[model samples]
Structure formats: structure tokens, C-alpha cells
Target: MKACLILLLLAAVLPVSAQQLPVDAVKGDYIVGALQLPEAGVLELQSPDGQLLRRQAAPAGESEFRFVALQSGRYRAGLASPQSQGRVWLTEQRPLEAQLPEVAAPEAPLASPKLRALANELGAGTPAFWAAVQASGAPWIEPIPDHPQSWQVSFLWRGDASTRSVRLFWPVRQGDQERFARLPGTDVWHYSVRLPSGTRLAYQLAPDVPQLKGAGRQAQRRAILARVQADPLNLRRWAAGTPALGGFDNIQAEHSLLELPGAPPEPWLEPRAEVPRGRVEHLRFQSQQLGNERRLTVYLPAQKSAEALPLLLLFDEDAYVTRVPTTTILDNLIASGRIPPLMAVLVGNPTRESRSEELPCNPRFADMMAGELLPWLAARYPVTREAGRTVVAGSSYGGLASAWLALRHPERFGRVLSLSGSFWWAPARPPGFVAGGLDDAAEGEWLTRQYVAAPRSDVVFYLSPGLLERSAPSDGPGILETNRHLRDVLMARGQRVIYREFAGGHDYVNWRSELAEGLIALLGAP
Candidate 1:
């Protein structure tokens, strides 16, 4: 009774955190959900600007997750898991740029006048789309609802000054957007479009621009058109924009035209050999440093590469290699031209035998990649030698490892892909919550101190979490707290972070879906 009273008195005497509203302003639609982790540990979340929001804890026993409910914005997340040994920076959850899906509809029109206006503007008959695209500087999209069997098209053009016969693209519905058609023999060039019926496609209108300042090619086009093509079950054999014997390929409508110069920060994937092979190379290697070297496998592509290729190294080797088999996804994406061709190195975590040590912030284990493994493979294949060419990736603890590589050895890794980063700062609080009277103000301060000193970098962060978690009912800073805490830290450091949360529990399905888009956002698209 005396001890209880003394504790109560201590709590009463401590300073109170300024009262803020609960995460009440947040709606599920606004939340970026689906935070799953490997080891259940405590985490603290923050805003992009470092404001303490909500808090949650993920213990070590189960793979529970904690997500943050933040205002819609670009934010980064970090994870520092707790251990009897010490608190180590594990993974910094990638940031969440949670764009609501409804926003996509408004963005879909190409611009505003309305759907009909958008359609008309691109010959799909929409002026709103034209106006919006023109005003926003977004790409032109052709809305093609009527021509189910016909290809969609949006033609934003730059006319040739010399009025020479300039080769042009053949626009079509559901055609690729990543390719360009060069004019044949300087004659009047006409791009063709072919597609099957009942197929829906979104299209972009682009001008044939100069190649390496070449003077021979002249052009004509303006306010490039955004076109769409759809047909009523026409079932065409091929949607070939490129004519036979031509050097170019179809620029599918879904593909983006421009790719950034440098590799994406993290959580973004560039290209991978998307076609999974019939026989998986179920290989395993033991890391002397990592202890039980779990199943570290590789998926070799059947399609040959002229030169050695870049690699997609996935953390969380178990689930990602098994259930999702990111390698398989890469193979398919590469074959479809949705993404580029690259190899996959699915690195599993250390066994429960040594997981606690290997996944944490240990520079020794990091050496394995930089010193021995990465270079050994590079010697054999034609892989990118630049740091930017390499993508250090994983989820949960794997997420921590990816981000850590960038910070610990920037010379070695260009980007990191962390999902549901386990920033395990203890914000022992309750659900649907914010930092409570904390039981004490000093507790929050201590957490701030712990986070302020961790290693970090300009690596891109892809983070997502479940909106809730399984922790003591009285614990503060559940999901919201952890997300907010890290979001603030990365943003303050001026790191490129994409923080998001989903309304789901900690599981593989959520991670699989989140990480799938993560590849595109990190490498596939960016």
C-alpha cells in the first residue's frame, strides 16, 4: 500500500503533457493501414514535423503492429526495437503518402470540366480533363469509354518547325506508355493502335521529343492529348503501336513516360525479372555473424540478360519469398513490361536462434553485405556498381536493416525499403489513443532523447502500419504514437519519407499488398 501510494504521488507530481484532442479528427479513409511486423516490440510514432501524436507497442512474442493516425501528408517513419541487450535502430518504416482512392477518380478525369468534358477534350469528349491537365501540369489522359474495341488516345503536341515528315506514335487503348515510335525513312509517320474488345485502358498524350539533341527530327503537336481506348469484347490479337521491323515497342498506357534521374530513395522499385521460373532455387547459406542463416533463396529468370542486371534484395525472406515470392512478381512484371528486368535476392532473417541479434542495429552483420556478399555477386554478374543501383530492402526488422544500411554505410546502399518499420520506442499507452498524462511527462521526454540520437540518412522510407495493436489497455502512444514519432524524426532530418497506415491487423496479406505497391513506388514506378 505504501509503494502504491508513493507511485501515485510520483505520477501526481510529474508534469502533464499539454492536452490535445484524441485522434478523433481522423477517419478510416484517411488512415494508411496494414502495419505488420516480424517481432512484436514497442514503437513510437511522430508527425513529419516531429509532433507527438499517438503511441503503441509491439511486444517480442507476436508479430503485432502499431500504426499512426496522422493528418494527410508526406511523412517518414523509423523503428528502434527494444532488447534486453540494448535499444537498436532496426528499420525506419517507409513514409506514407496515403492518397485516398477517391482522389484518384478526380485525378482520373485528366482535369475537371467533368467526365464528359474529359472524354471530349481527348476526343473522349471531355473539356474538363483538358483544362485540368493544362492547368495542373499533370500528363494528358484520354478518356475512352465509348470505343471499347478502339484504342484510347490523348494527343498533346509539339509541331515540327520545318514541317518535315516526322515519325509519330500510334495511339491505342490499353497500349503501353513507356515506349516511343520513331518515324520511318523521314516520310509522313503514322503511329498505329491495335487492341481487343472489352478491354479498358487509360492513355496519355505525349509529343515526340528530341533524342540527344539530334537535328534531323522535326515535330508538331501541342497541349498533348490524353486518350483512352475501350472496346466491347472485340478481342484483338495484339495492341501493337510499333509497326513490324520497327525499332520501338508499344508505350503501354499504364506506364509512366518520364523516369527520375537518380534511383528512388527507398520503398520504390525500378525493374525486376517478373517471370517466376518453374523450379525455385531453394538455397540456404549460414551467416557466421547472423547465426542460423535462414533460407536465403534466389529466383533466376529464364529470359536472358545481355549484361548482368541490377538486383532486388528483399528482407523478410520467409514470407516474401514463400507466400508473395517477390521474385515471382518481378518475373511477371518484367515480362509484361510493367517493370524492368532485374534479379532477386530474398534474404531471410536469422533464425529465432539469433534473430534478436542479427536484425537489430549491429554494424558487424551489416559488414556481411558490404564486405563479402554484395561484391562477390557483382564480380560474377553485370550488376550496378554504384550505390544508387543497389536497393537494400525488407519489411519489419528487415525494414530496419534496409534503412540502417543507408545510414551506417551510405557508400554501399543507395536506397532502403522498409515496411511497418519497428521503431520500438516505448509509448506504453492505450488504443484509439494519444500520449496520455503518460502516467508522466518525463517519459515522453526520455523517448524524445532516445530517438534524437539514432543514425539516419536521406534514404527513401516506405512505411505502413495497422491502425491498432495488442498492448496493455493503459499504454499510451499505440500505433499513432510510433508512427508520429518516427515521421517527425525523418522529416526533421530532411529525409525523403513516405508514411502510411491501413485499417488491418499485422499479417502477411497486408504486407504483401503494401510491399507490392512499395516496389513500384520505390523501384517499379519511381
Candidate 2:
């Protein structure tokens, strides 16, 4: 009886006829499995904590399954029956070029054609090669022989024996970190990427990022911030403190600017010595509808007229005033006759939380803007009451709010200027819906659907979304896709729409230039 009980207990504790095979794979490689099953079952790929990552159906005959390893970790693969089980260990490896950099001089081939040619001439990773690179400046931008629209950008870092890793903190892709590969037997590390000729962005480099053992992926990734700083080789710096409109709080956190040759000209960014300036008055405004008090920065054109001037109500007052030179842009545009003389009310948020609550298609907020704020502004200044001459403009969530307000009160705001609008926003989601997960198709594009359902209004729109604002595979439609969808919906309704895609990301750096372009498109002189 004791022996029988021991055998039963062992059977219950151990897997029956199951073998766990250890498999190795590199990050970004797909792991495929061919299996023979006696009965129809399901194959499941799970995380370390047993959370199902993927599932595939397996028939009673031979079957195959594949899963891409996105990160370095241990994953569990199992069938419905415990007889088939395996463990996968995914690790990240440097590219082949980085591992084989000691090839014969003048005959060696490299992943980058430019680097190959340079290696043929001066030898790879030699002191003379580095001297030439330093003199030529970086990140080294070279035109692709056949591709005129794109350029190859190579970022280089000089590392010593103590250096373990180098990461690039470019904000083009969310939650993705790029690393530089070290050349074999040399102190040179490099990573190259292709970008459109019109690309303009800010980036930082993190050298020797510490490895945090047993920490989550995000916590480990964020540890790079300890060593993150502007590129030493890149001379151009962004957000260096200038003054009221161009000042940043932290000078040490300044990023290196990368402006391609084809980037659009920001003619209105800096104050011109020849152009007349605008006056900005700071005042406190209290909203009874929303029961909040906030600051408002009012911009009056240099040339004052007795007649009512066209009005612009822009959200995120502080950002427009400080991060972007709004007053300077307005002055230059008005002086050059690109746009008519206009008065602008830069709307401020009462609190950060209030901005979240009020900016995303809030009816009460739109009502306050139309019923309370419009009347208040008309009483204080010689602003227009006609909708055709009035414009509501903002970026991101504020962009969504601008469209919502105009749709809610067309008589108050006829023109909407939205830059990288958050059109993939829905008011509600189904229970257990995970954002940016595999099953994220619950609800989105609420405002676009609202436009389709509601009657067409006499509202003109200027929509601009960056080409780089694309979402990951798990996430739903991103800013660029949703903006295009909104533009199509507006055109289908016979509304006048001007849509453009910029070769940048959802950044204030891009929005500053896009703002002037949007104003010229909507309210420019005919």
C-alpha cells in the first residue's frame, strides 16, 4: 500500500511522457516548431508568468507554429497535452558586421556601403578614419545613390574597454530602444538608419547603460536615463534656454538636433529685425461652466485696426508661448502678409488633470468656449463674431478638442487647425480591453464617427499628421492613419479640408512649424 501511494503521488506531481527541451534563439528571430499530435489540440506560447502570449490550433496530424521573439527572455511553449513542452531562451546578438570587423584592409565588406568604401580607403576603425569622421561631423548624413527622398544617417560612439553598451534614445518609435554595435577589436561603435530627406528630430545618446538584474523590461530600459545626454559630436543643440518663447527649464537635458536638407523652412520661428513685433498680455481667466481658473496669454498684432480682427483660440498656452515662438510666428506671418492681422487667445489649462478631462471632446468644455469665453473675449477686445474669420487650433489631444469644439459650435469656430490630432480616441471601451495589446480592437475614432453621424456643418479643417506617427502591431490605428481617416470622412461630407503629412514625429518641434503652415492654409491671404 505504501509503494502504491508513492507511485500515485509521483504521477500527480510529474508530467506524464513530457519532455522540456531547451531551445535558443536570437531576439527578432522567429521560432518555428513542427509537431506530431495524436489528437487535435491547441499550442500556446506563454510568458514566464504563464500568461498566454499566443495561441495556435493544432490538428491531429502534423502541424507547425511560429512566434517572433521580440525581446530577450525565457518563454514557455506547450500543447494541450503535457506530452509536448519546451522552453525557449531568446538572447540579443550583435550584427554579423560588428563581429567580423577585422577583415583584410581594402578588400573587406561592411553592412554600410559608405563605411565599406571608407574602410577600403583608410582602414576600418583606424585613428585616421575616426579623424576624418570627426572633421566631417556627425551624425554623418549621406545621400543614397539612387534614393533621393531618403538619406543614410550613421551615429558613431567612441568606447573604451569599460564601455558595455550604447543606446540611442530617438523618440521616433515609442517603447523601442536602438543600440550601437561595437566593431571587433576596435573602440568604435555605430548604428545606421535611413530617414526621409525632410526629417527633423531631436535625439540623445546613452553610453554604458547599466544592466538591472531581475527588473522589469521598462525599469531596465529606463535605467539608461542615468547616462543619457546630447550627442557630443553633434554641434546643433535644441531647447537651449533663449528667453520667454524659446526657453527650456533644464539646459543639461538639451537634445541634439538632426535637421535634414529638405526640412521645411521655419520662416516665422525667430523674431525678425525688420518685421514688426506683437504684444502679449498675461491675464487670469475664470470659467464658471467648468468651475476652473486658468491663465490666458493674449496676443495683439503690432498693427492695430479699428475694425474687428480675425481671432485665433489656441490650446496649451504655455507650450505655444515658451516651447514655440507663437508671438514671433504671428508677427512674421502678419508682417509678410502671409496671413491677415489676427488677435490670438492662448488658452491655458487649470491643472494637468483638468487638461486631461477637458481637452478630449468634452461637451461642457466646448460649451464654455462658445457660450462663456467667446462672449467674454468679444466684450474685452475687437475680435470678430463671425465664424468664418475665427479659428480654433491645437496639437495632439488639444487638436481633438479643437475639432470637437468646432463641431459642437460651428457658429463660434468655423476653422479647425489640428496637428497630429489624437483621432484614435474613443470615449468608452469594452470590459477587459487592454490598450496596445493583441486584442485592442475594442473602440476608437469616436470623433470621426461622430462627424459621419451628425449633419454636415460649414466648418473648414486644416489637418496635418506626421508620417512617422505610426503605431506598433499590437496597438490600433495611430495618429497618421486616424488623421487620414478623418480627412477622408470630412471630404466625403463635402467639407473643405486641407490635409498634409510631415516627415517627422508627434513632437512640438514639428508642430511649431506646422502651426504657421496651418494658419496660412486656413486663414491666409487669397
Candidate 3:
């Protein structure tokens, strides 16, 4: 009797503080929505103010939900997938409105005056006729960034007699998030952050400057950005001195302890380090929480440069041909030139609970992609900045996420390639948020309804699922019926839809076979 009364009182008090409102009706408010897809991942909701609130699962079909508006200001509807997050512009001016009660800002970060001077000097090195700017410097000209990812960036210029540490300082996310870079293999910083996916913050660096008192407690490790100079043109031009190759020569930890067959001619050749290719990179990585640092690996077509080329943004690092053996399909296709030589970013997924964070349908993910990932990638490669030229692709939970990114940020990406998308899965729900998700049959109908409802999106999609007839006769019937229904609904809505089926189950092999065909459809090749 006492327990029952406590439960009743708890429920009553909860609504008074954490109000429960319908999702779809969330006008002028921000929320995160997630749904469990039938096969792979969860569907999530993201908004413009860096928050995730709504969620719905996929039916191997359409998934939907509604939010109630307890307050009105500016709101956007967001969706989450494995590697990406997106939001619909429900309002024009999407500013950050307080989700909870208003709070005061944290104290300003203590500035290292010496580091600041070095950073400021680096920021002013614009070129005159390009070559003259290069010749004007006699001793040393360090790389300076205009819009660094962190509040401070510092580095040491190995020089004779004495060495100076250059640093740059900037605000990170105006107080929301920031970016930082640290020494290779030394993420001595960033031990306190437990952020969601797609969080963007500002950062800077100082060359060999004194370390801050609470470095790890406040920021992620430092990352290197492309050269920044005094002029906008300098941002476009490369630095005179090459960035450090870091440790391409010392490949893996196992290299020192191995004596295997065909260890290759030079056993000293390490994986990719600095740039975006090979088995590893010199670039620093971040985790959604205080965890281990991830080494980035980039896959670029031969002859890739900072020029206009077909770009495919991959969320899961392992989805590439090498990891997932995706190269087989690409080899057959690209060798025959079925698809153009494109750049692929195989960023590894986040750590424990990062799946829910990065794949969140929250505004933070979009900011991360736009303010974080894109800027990082653009620094390394000559990327196609236009949405019409770029594509986003993923599989399982990743696939669902790919679709969500296209749905919200159509202006940044054009084509979406989803394979074995786990639209049925989502980032795990917080404790006590036991909201029932859509079942297969019901979800299929909702997708059908969305096709009938929402405006025709300015994106192209390729969907392929295998035989589910043996799994659950109900789900099998649901798949076929839902597929056909969505196809017709999309086509009737004037969408260019491409649907196909394979002879396997829900795995990488099936998705691999379908990749070529999907490429042809999206790439517009014969």
C-alpha cells in the first residue's frame, strides 16, 4: 500500500517538472525522437538547438510520432540514425531556447597571455602575391588558423637556439561545445566530456605552450586544422612547410613483435598517418564521453586532391570495402568506371553509448557534422561543398541514419544510400522513458502514410531488403506489402525511388551486391 501510494505521488510530481507533451505537437520547442527499426537501428528525433528528444522505430516501413507543444518559440523536427542526425526546419529562426530553466554561463576560461600572443601573430600571416608572402619570412612561419576548433591551439616550431610555442584561442559553441587537438597518442586532455553525437565546439592551439591546469577536465584532445593565414585566400592555400607525417613509418604495435610470411618488403611501413588514407592517420579523434582516443583511417581514390569530385560521407568506419570488404564491389565498378573516383570518409562509430549519441535525431549531430566533421574533412580534401554533389551512405543502423541526414540536411547532402538499415533500432532510451514504439505492421502503414503526407523531399534514396518470408510470415508479408506500398506512394508523390531484392539475409554480403546497382541509380551511370 505504501509503495503504491509512492508510485502515484512520483508520477504526479514528475509531470509538474518534466512535463509530458505529445511529440508531433512540439511547436516552438525542441525534442529528440527515436524509433526502433525492424532490422537494424532506432529512429531518433533531433532539433536545431542541439538537443535530441523524439524517437520512433521503423517497420521495415514508415515510422511516425507526434509531440505536444507546452511552449512556443522555434522548433524543428529531427531524426536519428547510426552515423548521422538531421532536423526539419519547422521554424525559420532556429535559436537556442532554454529546454530547462535558464542558467548562468560558466566562468570565462583563463587565457595564457603568452600563448595568446603567439596565436594572434600566427593569425596575421597573409600572403602578398603568394610568393612574396612565402619569401618575406626568413626564420620560421608557423601555420595559423582563423577559425580554429578550440579556444586555444598551440604548437612548437623545432628551431635552432630556441623554440616557441604558437597558440590560437577562440570560443567553442558560444558555450555549448568546442574542438581541441593534442600531441599524437597523447589525449591528456578531454577526460571529462560526455557529449552526445554531433556536438560542435570552437578551439585553437599554441605551439609548445605551457599546458593548462585543467586541460583534460574541460576539453577533448587537440586536432590539427588546415593552415590558416591572415587572408581568406590563405585559408584556401596550402602551407609552405608540410604538416608532420606523424607516424606512418611505425605502422602498428604488432609490427615490432611479428615475423610472419611475406611481412612485406619494408616491414617498417606504417598505416596512413597524417592525411585520410591507409590503416591509420596522424589525425586525432574524439569520443562522445571520456574514453579512449580513436585513430582515423581515410579511403580516397587515387589522384584525389582538393578539387570538385564525387564525395561519399560514410558514418561507420568499418563499412568500407576493406573492413566490410566493400572494395570488391568498388573495384569491379570503379575499374570499369561505373562510378567516378570519389572520396570516402570512414569515420569510426562512437564508443559505449555513442551509438545513441551520434545516431541521435538531435540538433547537436547536425552541428557536429556541419561545424565539426565537414570542416575537418574539407581541410584534408578538396570536397564538393554543394549538397547536390555530395552523397551520404550507410547500412543497418547506419542506413537508417543516412536516410535521416538526407531528410533534414538535404542542403548538405543529395543522395542517401541505406543498406540493411536498422530502422527498427535506436539509441537506447533513458531510464524511465518507457515509451512504446511502433510494431512492424503499424510502422509499415506509417511509412506509407508519410509518403502520402510529408512534402516531397529533394533527395534520392535506394532501398533493398532480402527475403524475410522464413523469419516471421507476418513480417515477411509486412515487408513485401510495405515495400510495394511505399514504392507506389513515393512514385505517386513524384519521388524517384529505386527498389530491389537479393537472395540473401540481412547482412553485409547482401548489401554489397546491391551497392553497384544503387550506385548506378544514384551516380546515374549505365
TM-score against truth, every candidate: 0.42, 0.72, 0.41
Q: Local error of candidate 3 at 343, Å?
A: 0.2
The lDDT, on a scale of 0 to 1, for candidate 2 is 0.72
Off by over 4 Å in 2: 1-110, 120-123, 208-226, 240-252, 429-441
| Global Cα RMSD, each model | 22.8, 16.6, 23.3
Clashing pairs in 2: none
Best by TM-score: 2
lDDT of 3 by residue, 1-526 (tens): 4534533453453222111222333343322232322222234334435365434322221222333233453333433443433222221111123222222222222133433353345432222222333333211122224522222212212222222223332211123122232222221111122221112221233222222222252211221121111222122221111111111110000000111122123211123233223222324466342243433455556544466767676655533423244444444455455677666665554332344445534345645665567667787776778776677777644665676676667778778776655444322443122222343333334324534767787677787654321234333333334445556776887877777754333434344456666776787564
Q: For model 1, how many clashes?
A: 137
Can you rank all candidates by TM-score, best first?
2, 1, 3
Tens-digit per-residue lDDT, 335-380, candidate 1: 6655556667777554332444555445666777777668766775
On lDDT, who's better, 1 or 2?
A: 2
- Alpha-carbon deviation at 139 in model 2, angstroms: 1.3
The predicted structure with the larger lDDT, 1 or 3, is 1
lDDT of 2 at 507: 71
Write candidate 2's Cα lDDT for 1-526 as tens digits: 4534533453454332232323333443334444444433455566544577644444333444444444556666666456644322222222222121222212112447777687679987788988887787788888988899999898888777766677888656543567778777777778888889899887888775544334476545554544567888888888522111111111125578999989988788988899988888988889987777877899999997888999999997756776688999999999999999999999976644466567878778888999999999999999999999999999888899899998889988999999998898876543222221112444788889989988999999999998888876656788899999999999999999999999888677788899999999999977
lDDT of each: 0.43, 0.72, 0.40
